[model samples]
Target: MTTTLPEAPPAEPGLKAGLKNRHLSMIAIGGVIGAGLFVGSGSGIATAGPGILISYALVGVLVVLVMRMLGEMAAANPTSGSFSAYADRALGRWAGFTIGWLYWFFWVVVLAVEATAGAKILAGWIPAVPQWGWALIVMVVLTASNLVSVSSYGEFEFWFAGIKVVAIAAFIVIGGLAIFGLLPGSDHPASGFSNLTAHGGFLPNGPGAILTGVLMVVFSFMGSEIVTLAAGESADPQGAVTKATNSVIWRIAVFYLGSILIVVSLLRWDDPAILKDGSYVAALSSIGIPHAAQIMNAIVLTSVLSCLNSGLYTASRMAFSLGRRSDAPAAFGRTTDRGVPRSAILASVVFGFVAVAFNYLWPDTVFQFLLNSSGAIALFVWLVICFSQLKMRRIIEREAPEKLVVRMWLYPYLTWATVALITFVLAYMLTDTADGGGRDQVVLSTLVAVGVVVVAVVRQRLGRGAAHDAVTSSKA
Candidate 1:
């Protein structure tokens, strides 16, 4: 007699395959390009000087390698759980459970942060509304958009991302011209890459600043992996993943590194403008554009909203996938009549609201804690992907190598190198405290990492006990 395995539960219905190729493409482009680049690049540039370009390039290469590994896995088995599911199949149930919860935790925290940030911007534009009120409005609107259907979410993201892409492209083009002294009334005489060496000679803070910059730059690339997650629901998972993986490198190089080059070139490394105003906003304003702050504020608002919308969708789908795998409560796996994971969406949104409440009542304490605690999960998630792909590639090669069309280049060599570099970065982050911000990042990331390890161990023991009980009952 043959022993039979249990059947897997059916995938929840109502998740419409409404997201077209265009939506997935734009989302892949937009998800990686967050408000952080627009707002946070200034600080990196100020610290690293013109050498921040090298910092972005370094982080970009890491992202490219990570995404390629993820694409290889996602193209083979397109699922919402993404790296978590890959970890399960390639590594073990414990790896899956840990990374899934970690990734989920990362996004829910981000939902709160982004919502709060967007609210502040809106509140400034219309002071009649309270900040919390703006937060509520932003959350509700985006939640509804997600609830309508994934297609609706994709459509909204398409336009949101379109605006950002256009803005960045134009900024790059205009800024490039201004740098070359081609713009009207611009007698600055093509800075000719002199800004890079003029101040402290590139790497002024020493090569250590590049390593320090890695911590922030890595986080900026966090959302880029979402493309693989969303691609699973697309009509053509392999094609989508392939295109996204292939193009993302150049995109990062051009948009992120390219824009930073322009900013530092146009303005001195130690200029008060770089410190006082944001990178993009300051660059535009320096060129004598009117209402530059307001214009960039609106763009940043859109980027924040887009991120929030994607956050909700990503968290819900991840929860839904976890439920389907029995790693989470079964309720999360169920869908509404329209195929939406209503419970999952509502659960994630409720947490977002709680975060918002904390932001209002204990702005400095509870909210700040949440932000710090969940800060390092992105690194955890990427590390898991690297390991998963290392294991999964062989399995795929054995079972069906043809499916490995989008394989990670150079296989285990590059994968291991990426892992080593990430480990080094983490180690560096822990030790380097040239700035207060870096020290805080190290402490918070360490705490989050420790918490994830503890959870993984407990979950593993519990799973083993459950398995043992089942075997004993069957024997009886």
Candidate 2:
């Protein structure tokens, strides 16, 4: 009796249940370890000193709560549409239409970013091939993986995420050993707990720097919620979601906070080596790890490829969901005999290809606009998830409480608190006007969100009018 629309996938040509439990497990663990962690965390360290750990912690908690709300809804009624479909039922057509496109917009832009990042690394190793050519090659390869079947995508992710998991775990263990002076070759003067506060105190730049660090690190957590979208294709979506939600804490704690804690402990946050070499590399090198930069670069490239693969898969599924709901072209709704939404995949990647071109041809002007415009979307998606759950919880409890295997702790109170926290983060981003591009991101993303909302509203009204006319004609 829930208000959610029934997704009769078997009754129609629909997505296959292709993701295995192993694939979902790896994704849950490794999704938190993005290329950004390797490629971007140094900037946060420079901005907030050792206090960047606090920034990661705050954002980690935020992601856990958002995933909890998302898990509850998805467990009750699994669908590839994920939050967008829930928004439709709990809020309205307009909410689903708007957020779906926005989320899709986010990942496609991500595809370009990840593709370029991976290509740069590839070109470094194989200097004969230009970066642009490498980008094209990776994009095509990953797109093909997605187009083959969901299982192919899952298999590719399983290994990609696996490599990331191993790299981060190894880094943490090696770095932690060096911090306590247990690492045999690590006689670096900086290795000790004192580095946390002894150098310049933990809050070296003052406590306000934590907020700046949040802006720097917040987007790095963008891919955390991807597991929920992926759960829909698993053998048991509700179970997959439940397990992923329960484990999010340790995943973020170990991979993000634990590794970063080691980095700060192993070396001072203000180390010139950190700013010159990346955080992970700097930490490893301080501990006498040879070829640290090269090792980190390989790990980062793997992370980038993993992100690109998942970005395509996530975006296409969202587009397919939108098409199924009539918020997009029906062609996006069509699937192959293999249950792949081929059109949806192509559409998403085509845009990604164009965005990649923009990065090369017009990076300064057009590509920057695209990047900033999609910047705040992760917050927007989390906000919508929070709102959707507030309504969804009531509907599920009143109708099918039995399906409420996963519940948000403290119900509406925590939900609202999460809402306020997300709003505060957004407000923080809006006000922080400096080199971080916070203000530009908020404004440009808002402009894009407003445009999407207008289209959703007009589309909803027009559909309603058409339905009314059809009913009148039948009556006559």
Clashes of each: 3, 0
Off by over 4 Å in 1: 1-14, 185-189, 433-446, 449-453
Q: Give all TM-scores, in the order shown.
A: 0.94, 0.97
Q: Candidate 1 residues 31-135, lDDT tens each?
A: 889888988888888777777888899889999999999999888777788888888777777777778877888889889989999999999999999988999
lDDT of 2 at 151: 94
Error of 1 at 169 (Å): 0.2
Which residue pairs show collisions in model 2? none
Residues 1-476 of candidate 2: C-alpha lDDT, one tens digit per residue: 65464332322247788899999999888887888898899999998999999999999999999999998998888888899989988888889999999999999999999999989989999999999999999999999999899999999999999999999899888887777778776777644688889878999999999999999999898887788888888889889989998999999999999989988888878889888989999988887889999999888989999999999999998999999888899999899988899999999999999999999999889999999999999999999999999988988898899999889999899999999999999998988786439889999999999999999999989988999999999999
Local error of candidate 1 at 327, Å? 1.5
Cα TM-score of candidate 1:
0.94
Residue range with the least summed lDDT across 10 consecutive positions in model 2: 4-13
Scored against the true structure, residue 270 in model 1 reaches a CA lDDT of: 82
